[model samples]
Structure formats: C-alpha cells, structure tokens
Target: MSAAGPSLIEFVAKRPWLKKALTPLASWYGNAAGYRQLGLRADDLIPEDNERNLQALSRLPPKEAYDRIYRIRRATQLSLQQKILPRNEWTKPEEDTPYLSPIIERLAAEEKERDQLDTLGVLKKH
Candidate 1:
C-alpha cells in the first residue's frame, strides 16, 4: 500500500532493468510536478485532511514537523505572491525525499493490522 492505494514499488524494485528504466522518468516527473520549484518537497503536496495523513503528521519528530510546516507556509506565501523560489532555492532532487510517506505507510500497515485483529471471531456450530 502507498499513499495512493496499491503500490507496485516492490515489484518494480525487484526488476533491476525496469527500475533502471523508470528511475530517470520518475525523477523527471517529480521535477515537472512543480512542487520543488516552490521550495517544497514531494511530501509537502500530500493533503493534511485525511486520517492516515493526520496520524503520520502527528508522528513526525518535532523538528521535522516544524520544518514541514515552515515549508508549507512558505510555499503558500510564494503561491499567493505568484512567485517561485529562485533556481538555486528550488528543492533539489536529493532534498525532495519521502519524509512523510514512510510514516503514512507505517500508519496504513498498523490500521490494516488492527482491522485484521478486530475481525477475529470464534467459530460457532449449531
């Protein structure tokens, strides 16, 4: 599972050739998505309204959470001003890492586990 439902990340990773082929395109898409231009990481684009995302946001380390908020507020300010960060100030490829996603994935896994446990029922025979 990913932030966007079922993920093929593991499957793609297991295929070296396919992963290699896709890596550049993925990078290109990430850059083209435009969040980085606003000095925001990929994770900053995730909506904060959902349960899993809210849980993930809460679980982030204090400094990391603070940084995330700063980035978002800055981006919002930039957006309202109809401006983007200067080229050098744009989020670099290496800096656009998945800070929130791993936590979200973990939360999703925990929810799945809890649901599985809650569904347990004793057998009854008539």
Candidate 2:
C-alpha cells in the first residue's frame, strides 16, 4: 500500500503465535504477490520474542500477496473438513479442497441445505 506496506515486526509484536499458525499463508502470499524479497527473518518481526512470523510486507511482490490469500482460502476449507469449522460458512470456498467439493454438493439435496441455514436449525433433533 505504501512504500513500506506493513511492518511484520510490528504486526507480530501484538499477535504472537501468528507465524506458526499462518506460515503457509504468509509464505504463499509473499510468493504470489511477485514480491522479490520475502524479508522473512526470525528477529525482524519479533523483537522480544525474536520469532516474528515472517518478513517485510512492503518489499514483497504483488503476486506473493495474492498467493497468500489463496493459501488462507485453502486453510479455511481444511478447517471445515476437520469440522473445526462448518461447511455452511463457505458460501464459496476460499480455495477448493479435494475432500469438500463432493460433500458440499450433497448439501444441495434441499434448498434449505443449499441456503446454508444455521447449524442448529439444520441439525436440531425435533
């Protein structure tokens, strides 16, 4: 956005554990944005923790940023299949997963299902 996009160090200072959780997303975003420099250094993002998530957002390429979004999309699907998240949330997948496509279609059996009503409504044991 700016000459200096986002400071990774500043970002991780508040949100620790982000690096570990979002490594896949960060790396992919960096790559997709066509960013030349990942700028990923353990010390850059985290001063005290010394383990910031990744690198310089500003130096990164646009392609890398895009890739990052895609990764997050994929991660979202995996979360659904694990049942950590629900399928209804995926009005459209962030990215498709091999496992979820067929099952998502089955939801089309009824309009209500396709409409993606609240889980309590769908699963309530009348």
Candidate 3:
C-alpha cells in the first residue's frame, strides 16, 4: 500500500476487465524484471535497509527468514560473478510469491494505528 510511487495495479485490479487484459502483460513484465533468473522472489528485491521492511523481515517465520536470506545471498554472489543461475536453479513463477509484503503491510497499518493512539486528545467534563 505504501509504494514509493503511484501504483496502477490497484486501479487495474479493481476492474475485472482491465485485470483480465493486463494479467499477461503483468506476467511478462515480472519475467522481464530478471530477478527470477537470479533465483530471487519479488519480495527479495525490496530494500531490506528500510525500517518497514526490516521489521517485516524480523517478523518472518524462521524457515521463511532463512529462505529469504539464502536467496538474497545467492543473488548477491551471482551478481558479483556476473552469472545467472543454471536453468534448473532459476526461480519458478510459482515460487516467486510476495512472502514479505503482507507482513510489511501489517506493520505499516500497526504503525499508523500507534500514531493515531499516541496523538489522541483527552477530554474530561464533569
């Protein structure tokens, strides 16, 4: 929800016709993004240094956290070597789900709620 820029996804998603027409385009764009070739999921491409993402990463289940770290390190090493993973090692589309996005969205919502509560005004009348 807290994207760095305006998202056309939400708009398109709300319209069934638009979503139907754009599904293939979106899939193609995801493939073209090239992270899958590096064996990384879309969530793995999110900047980990940011506060929200860091919190989300911390909240991940242990196995998920380990997998995320493994993928990131693998990607880093591959980038350094200027080599893509062998075809068999590439991330399959089904495996490229946004595992961390929901947690990040929850964290953002919690932060917003906390802000609201912290700023609440108290009124007393007798």
Provide the clashing-pair count of each candidate structure. 0, 17, 0
Using all chains and alpha carbons, the TM-scores for the candidates as numbered come to 0.88, 0.22, 0.90
In candidate 1, how many clashes are counted?
Answer: 0
How far off is residue 4 in model 2, in Å?
Answer: 22
Give lDDT tens digits, candidate 1, residues 58-109: 9999999999999999999999999999999999998888998889888888
What are the per-residue Cα lDDT tens digits for candidate 2 across 1-126?
112244475576567688678768866764454212222222122222211122233233578546545545555566556533343443222322233222222432443554665454645586
Q: Stretches of candidate 1 above 4 Å error?
A: 122-126
Give the 10-residue window scoring lowest on summed lDDT in candidate 1. Answer: 1-10
What TM-score does candidate 1 get on C-alpha atoms? Answer: 0.88
| Per-residue lDDT of model 3, residues 15-103, tens digit only | 99999998899899988999999999998888877888888988999999999889999999999999999989889989888889899
